[model samples]
Target: MNVMSVRRAEASRRAGGDRHERTVWPFAALVAAAGLVMLGYALLAQPGWLTGLTLTVCGTNPTAPHAVLLAGVLLMLAWGMARGRQTAWALALCLLAWSAAAELEAALAPSPAAPWRLAPLGFAIIGLWHGRSRFRVPLNATRLKQAAEISAFSVTAILVVGGGGLFMERSHFETPVSAPDIGRTVVSMAAANPGPAAFDGPAWQINGIALLSGGLVIVVTGWLLASAPAPRPAGRAQRAIVRAMVSHPDSETLAPFAMRYDKSYVFSADGRAAVSYRVLAGMAVAGGDPVGARESWPGAVEEYCTLVERSGWRPAVLGAGPDARLLWEERGMRSIGIGDEVIVDTGAFTLHGRSMRNVRQAVHRTERAGLVTEVIPERQLDPGLAGQLRRIHREWLGAAGREHGFAMNLDAMARGVHPDALVAVAMAPEGYAVAFQRYFPAAHAGRNAALSLDVMPRTPLSPNGVNERLIVDMIDYARSHGYPRISLNFAAFRPLLARARSSPESLTGAERATIRAIGLLDPLIQVDSLYRFNDKFQPGWNPRAVYIGSWFDLPRFAVAAFGLEFALPYDRRRTGRAVTAGDPGFEPLKGPAPVEAHRAVRH
Candidate 1:
């Protein structure tokens, strides 16, 4: 019966220990409290009292207070580890080994006076080891650098304090203690009073102080070297590769944004694929679909997602096409269809059908106003004319009150023209350029299949239908050049909302409510107007979506996506009185010095 009772007791204790290991918060709180106490003691404790307790007959022992300081540091490390900081876990392990060494020295004392202090720290180190799975994230370069810096600083502070205490002892004592005596006194708690004659020995014999310090530096440096490297911005070599891969046939309408300077790129090993993204507020936001060969997209996209996850940031793909949305959905992400991209088939585009009455009438009116249109490839445009166009662009931007756009607009056009770009200019009766549009190449599979409308800026004095005439001319030009398509502006939720409103009987209660909410936002966002304008072209609408991993990250992703597209406060100041709106989805602006109305252009 006695043996059975003992066995039951042992089992109960083992079970209790297991439960304790799982309960991290309670242990973490206790460790944190201990750390606070140690810090307070280190900061407020009388240095004279500390020196008095550890002093040998020869000099004060400086290493004694260090055990308390180290305990404090280790407690903090444990606290961080409990919160799932991998770097803290790594630092805790290093400190646990260090604390054990300190305790061993204390235990080696002739009298076991200070060894009793090791129990709390030992339990904490053990607790951390048992709960190691909680800290699964790898320590990144930023965390590694921070840990290394703190360790190096701590070691330096300890050396400084020990050296200062030694100088004071030497100044006060007639028989000053040698470095070897101080070392032996700290480790063994026995004063090595080898006399003043011992000081005449070699200077390098200052015991193992330098050796210990050097070893600590090496350990910290090695840990930092072993940490994962930080993610870098896209460089020139990456830009070149992106330019090449963007020529893939299946690239989406917004793929041209990849070539912009503001974004970063991640590529596959063979350089046949890439993901262009920008990081803001700890979110890696890819504006559109991966730009690469269809076969290579899965690898490049996975690489990008993994890179973002390892860097401890949220990954969000905004304005992704149907194919990209399906891919993200397959990866367990939820997608919300955001909008529709309008693609006009240049071969079939004609102002002949009854549905095209508005566009045709507008084009004819603009033509009657003697507004001559000229279509020229970007590289063939004269430098002086390009400069004037740039000025017009800046003026138009200033009037529109916009400074930057990420998803589908150019932040800078004055740099020079892209080789594959096409520019269409409308000249007024006086011959000065009044309206202009820019088209970027949308080539695929070794063929320039489509042209993406990028910029459309006209002077305030130009006629209203200048844009319609320009598009008509562009379609004629594309047909002549054998290019098949022209991708126009995106219209957010056009058909769904339109259908919901037009045929209210078909929609469920939730759909009606959603439609009503979207309808309310039309004035502010111009969703309805943009859709209606694009519809006049009778273009094929391709679906675009923004899929997110976590619902909670929606607000942050919104900020990152729009913040990149919208102008800052300083840019608002530069915008003057114009109220700039609509980006990624092109809409008209309302302001002083409003440019002549043209067909809505989208990047």
Candidate 2:
């Protein structure tokens, strides 16, 4: 054999080895299919004969009609299995369970017991061979040898018992045996009575039948219970479903929102409520009347108020309609400017002007510093890096005090609530993480994305130009990824910020009075300071107001007693002039300014 021939022959041998290794399971499956076919024919065609034989030997019929139906189903399943259908294999296993039960009942039966004497042994062989394929077991001639052994043992026990019973019966009839001699008989004989024995004497026939039937039932039940396949363990998706069902009230309560039916607000155990501000969108999609959509807001507001009253907690609501604000006022709930929603046109956007300047500078600086920004697919985010980014988030939270930063960012991600969004992180030169943002796709009438940015903690640099830089990076990222607009959220207490920027000369008399009254009892200065920080971003100022169906329904005494600092602006549609904070119209009741002094306040 030359080297070339030798190599070719060796490759052939290796290929053959692989083929042989893969054939074992298919071969076993073929054997199992053959066994199932035989069992099916016996179950469907000869069920009565089988049952009669079982009753004759066992003294009662234990096979249920459902068992026969299952066997037929398994035959169909076997056909599916022969063609390599996994679903068919699973169904076949279930059918096999019923077949096993029937077989066990036959084995334990007492009448005409000859035919089914081998039934239990046959079924046990099938189960051990096919069902135990996945279970570790020896596969050799030994399995056949074990079946033969069981058959031999079964035949020997049946022959001995049947022959011994016949011998005793024959002996009883052969001669007129004396009473003392008959008393020693293996089988019991009835005692002679003074009067002729009643023609049909009670023989404990029902009791014997009951005991035998019960025994067969217990044996069959035990075998079925023991042989049934254990359920496969839950996977990732199953685990997630369990968690959502058990722990998330928001998921359950807001299911209507998902189905685009109704909107709701859910309160968590921690006094946090998640209110859907765009509940009307879903109603609109369902072809609800425009007037009905308008009417839904008041009811939603009342429900939220009820939840607040019941839970004794308050949380911010997003994308609120005009009616929601009015309802908040009616319920005497305080409003604040938390953040703004920034929507940018992805296709129309260009990196230019003052808005684009900061981003431009940051990009240049980052490149000069040898730090690179790459827009990669979302899945490419390394797990280790993602974990590190989360740590940086914790650090940011620690520095800012957990109460001040965005509440939903960390909690939402931890719960795996938002799975549909794409996320990206920016890394510094030393591989230290700098920032991360999550983008949620648009829903309802809006086509926009939401971005969250956080710089590394303990960095002494000001956040002044950081947001614009992040926004630019995000916009660039989005443009490359084919996304349209981005929405930057506003603070809940945005009115306070609007108030601080307003000149006193711009206020009306009533507006000024309200502002003075609110400022006297609340931390107007502190709120003003916070709003000043958000104003630096130079975002488009959109003053959104709350709407109420009836202001009279509010807790007027509570509002008066608490002297709530911020109140939602009352809308005067004709002038488009909103009653806001810092309006000079404010005249303190007991201050140096007289009541008439407030009369001159005008916008």
Clashing pairs in 1: none
Question: Candidate 1 — worst ten consecutive residues by lDDT sum?
Answer: 588-597
C-alpha RMSD values across all candidates: 13.9, 28.5
Model 1, span 1-603: residue lDDT tens: 697567556655664664354355654565565455444444665366544423321022424244344434546555454544566666756666676766777789887556654675577678778777655446666757776687868566645654555554564444667777555433331121223433333333333443344345445544443324334555556766676666667776678777765678888666678888877756787878888787788888888876775565667887888766655654545577788888899878888989999998889788777887777655556767777787888787675545566667644463332445568888877867888888766554334367778878888878888777788788877767666888888788876766865797998888888777877988766677778878889999878888776687799887777666665553222233211222244232111231222222221
> CA shift at 378, candidate 1, in angstroms?
2.1
Which numbered prediction scores highest in lDDT against the true structure?
1
Candidate 2 lDDT tens digits, 115-179 = 45346435534653464333221222333354456545644543344334434444334355453
Supply the global lDDT for candidate 1. Answer: 0.64
Every candidate's lDDT: 0.64, 0.37
Candidate 1 lDDT for residue 403: 51
Model 1 TM-score is 0.63
Runs in model 1 lying further than 4 Å from the true structure: 1-85, 91-137, 142-233, 399-403, 444-448, 504-524, 567-603
